[model samples]
Target chain A: MKNATGIWALLLGLTLAEVALAYPSLAPAVFLLVLLALSVGKSALIIAFFMHLRFASRALTLALFPILIALILLLLGFLPDAQRVMHAA
Target chain B: MTRNETTWEGGGSPFAIGAKPLGMWLFVVSDALTFSTMLMVYTYSRLANPHWPAPFAFSPSIVQATVMTFVLLSSSLTMVWAVDAMKRDDRRKTVQYLSATMFLGIVFIVIHMREWVHLINDEHITLTANPWNQPLFGATFFGLTGLHMAHVTIGVVYLGIVALGTRMGKFKTDHVETSGLYWHFVDLVWMFIFPMVYLMSVKR
Candidate 1:
């Protein structure tokens, strides 16, 4: 099993990358993609290793993923409207 | 004597009381519903308002928030290690990992407080303040993030108690893994929140 230090290093590296990519020089769309990828990756790592989901039954693991998917669906569905509202306001 | 007074050293009834993990799962499910409702409200408000404010207009310091995210993430790592150590019967290592987990949780909460204070006192972005004169932005921002912060505070206290209890051997060996499940769930919620609340609106 991996130790906590390795996990911390991975999290730190990903976070620094996020901060660096937040600059305006980067394309906003590309930055958003990277951010989403990093967030999902970090989330998976925590859930699989820290949460012991990897060791848990398949049913339990499947149960958790749908809740996360629902959140993502909600975010994506509303984001466009949210952008329009901000522009209008 | 009451039936509850019966203590079987090693040969109790096969059907026992509620398992700790099952109890933890029930708590996690309830907590998940709370967050889901908040997120739903956030989505609904965003949909209704459309263009209430730009993300950067909020003036939250991205660097500080990102660092706090890392702290919380690292704490999750330590929490898992604590459980792993307990499974191996390494009490000292378990304590070490739990201590580290609790310390990181505290640091995250402290940084969160600093961010809130900076926003309220220096930035003057109160719950009543509206960007573009839209009241929904303030309400949604405060309501969603404030609710999440309350969870973080509760998690910190939970970790504190777990740390102290580990020292006193209050939890059986099996219970450590159960506690880890709850701690990890808390970390998972922050994973979503850090991006949605801090990073998502950065471009504006």
Candidate 2:
């Protein structure tokens, strides 16, 4: 696909942005947020374009999305408890 | 084109035999759950000891890990090329690209071995040693990264098998596409691990 090269360029740009965020002056939470955003963006691009999941049937995409959603929910749900435990320790 | 027939035929009906790409996605999802658990543990450990000093202060050898990351990521591109070649029915190009991917995968493993030796021998960050004055740092670092390296080693073996299969004309075009899916998933995991494990704790 002609668009594949452009997607890679976008990935490279995101990586560059991640490197820039490593600067100490950036707020730590903000840096983490930016990194997470870029990571999700890169994953989306790879899944949608390179994997051709974008062109696939809606049922297939729906099947995969639920698993990812559950994983995210699990991660977020445990974060507070983890933080509390860490602070207590 | 027969609209009356419910089944579209290639190697078999897509639903009957199941698409190889779909099967690979199922595997990837299972693998993702494994990595997610590891990452959750990593986060919990880090949270437990936020003030703990990192083991290595400014080791330039860590850059070797970065280089390895780049090599692994580039291999994904080769894998995509291999899949494209297969789609075009260019077996020769497919084999070449697969070989290139296998070679890069081996290079990554070799570099990883060197980095492991440096971490263990030079830095003395063994399982029993607390190099960073934190007990869990060495344990969790090695555990998470070691598990990832194990996955990479498994991927290399799989790629080698696929390379041989391609040479023998055992892999149908769809099979090559499926293998490519797994290869790209491996790359995807490393993309996350590279930043989280290697880059996250880097001192400014």
Candidate 3:
């Protein structure tokens, strides 16, 4: 119970930081990086604690880890193609 | 009270996580991939057109989306508390927490709907091309967020049924725990969507 409350506080702090970064004056590129990084931070906390992965065994963690890696790789693979199209036109 | 017996006690679950929870975890992973694909396409569309219109700025959608995020996050907290209450065999508190979670789920859906109405009616956005000529803008925005909203809607109904079952003394900790898994997964997805969709679109 105490831990859940602590996690909620941490999540809220991350959220506030994100809101601050969203201000129109902030550079879009910097905002994008910080916002996404904070998002990953927030997601890690939720997946680790809220989803009970923190206490889960290696078998469970190992099962889901590869999918995450593959999806990220897929994103990288798709990026340059989109950028190339943008550059051409 | 007799605890539920599992066939996996012998061999299937070497780690002893049990079949039901394991099944739930697998479902969550697959669902995560489904959203990831949609988000990937959204990223593709956003980058494909650097002039991709960000209609969220100068509108109420950002504020509304932030509120929705909080409502969903609060729902997630209630969901975990529901699981905790059930683990303690406190039926009343479990029902209370589940009900609160359901209410928050409904609140989230309502807020999102209002934002959509504002975008469509006042902002003149649609699933087709908006006045901005960024056709994919409305398409991806509504597509991804709509998918997540559907999940939230189903989650509300799912939690409602479970909450009712708990009120009638028809469920146990197992039910609440699984629901907690689903609810948290939904919240986790929104944590990504909130920044990816709303904040990133805010004009600079």
Candidate 4:
């Protein structure tokens, strides 16, 4: 409802930027970090604007996101094991 | 009891939104966790396998994926506009926007399947193996994108039903909004998948 066209434009620009960034030979870690940050930005815009989460109640937002983020972080804890495996290989 | 009843016994909506939309939001939350787990698995697999392949070339794969992203994003914008039209009680405009959204979704799926066929037929990438010799790349790539594609396919059918119901004076603004939530969620998932699956694997 808050003029999603602007948000759409921003999302498209971010996506294009991601493509252009991929063309460069950036370091793997740096490239990954930048891509993740840009993706988070795009997702935030989509959740806030298109999904109308921005108009949702603060209580609902609080009840929903924090726990979800925590669970996702917990899942991410397994990622370092992959690094260890890579080193061993 | 009336909706305005605000007793501690849960007589009213705590989230200040209707039950339907709230239910959809809960579903979105659960589904988000599912995708997150899959992505974690993908990242883990990629990192563990040092021979992970960045098989997608910019010519056909990345370019085609970019087009799919555009179509999906445009569908989301149209979905929100459909919700807006529904709120204004413009039933005709609502259906029109919804149809447009569905069309875009179909286009996205078509383009996506084309890319998949290219990979399978021309590039010899399957669910089990690929030219890169990293079987995990094919496994994770198809598993993730295939799951997301199924969602998009379901979403298109969901939007079709919502559109028909809205046109027949059955569904209301909340219904439109709920469907929009699902559509937008599908688009949001692509926001991550496009970059994680496609961009991160771009051929150097």
Model 3 residue B117 lDDT score: 91
Model 4: which docking level applies? medium
By descending lDDT, how would the candidates be arranged? 4, 3, 2, 1
What C-alpha lDDT values do all the predictions have? 0.68, 0.70, 0.83, 0.89
lDDT of 1 by residue, B1-204 (tens): 335543344344322323677567667767776776675566556444535454443246687787777777777777777888887888778889878877887887788887777766765566778546656666777787777777777776776677677778787665777767777777777765665556655645
Native contact recovery (fnat) for each candidate is 0.43, 0.17, 0.51, 0.81
Q: Please give, for residues B70-155, the per-residue lDDT of candidate 4 as tens digits.
A: 99999999998999999999999999999999999999999999999999998899988887788888888899999999999999
lDDT of 2 by residue, A46-69 (tens): 777767678777767787778886
The local lDDT score (0 to 100) that residue A40 gets in candidate 3 is 82
Q: Pairs clashing in candidate 2? A: none
Q: Show the colliding residue pairs in model 1.
A: A85-B50, A85-B51, A86-B50, A86-B51, A86-B52
DockQ of 2: 0.41
CA displacement after TM-score superposition, residue A55 of candidate 1 (Å): 1.6
Q: Per-prediction DockQ, in order?
A: 0.30, 0.41, 0.60, 0.79
Expressed as tens digits, the lDDT of each residue in A1-89 for candidate 3 is 78988898899878877887787566444665687789889988988888788988887898877877687777657755777777788
Candidate 2 TM-score on chain B: 0.85
Give the distance in Å from residue B101's predicted Cα in candidate 2 to where it truly belongs.
Answer: 0.8
Best by TM-score, which number?
Answer: 4
The DockQ-based order of candidates, best leading, equals: 4, 3, 2, 1
Candidate 4 vs. true structure, TM-score:
0.96
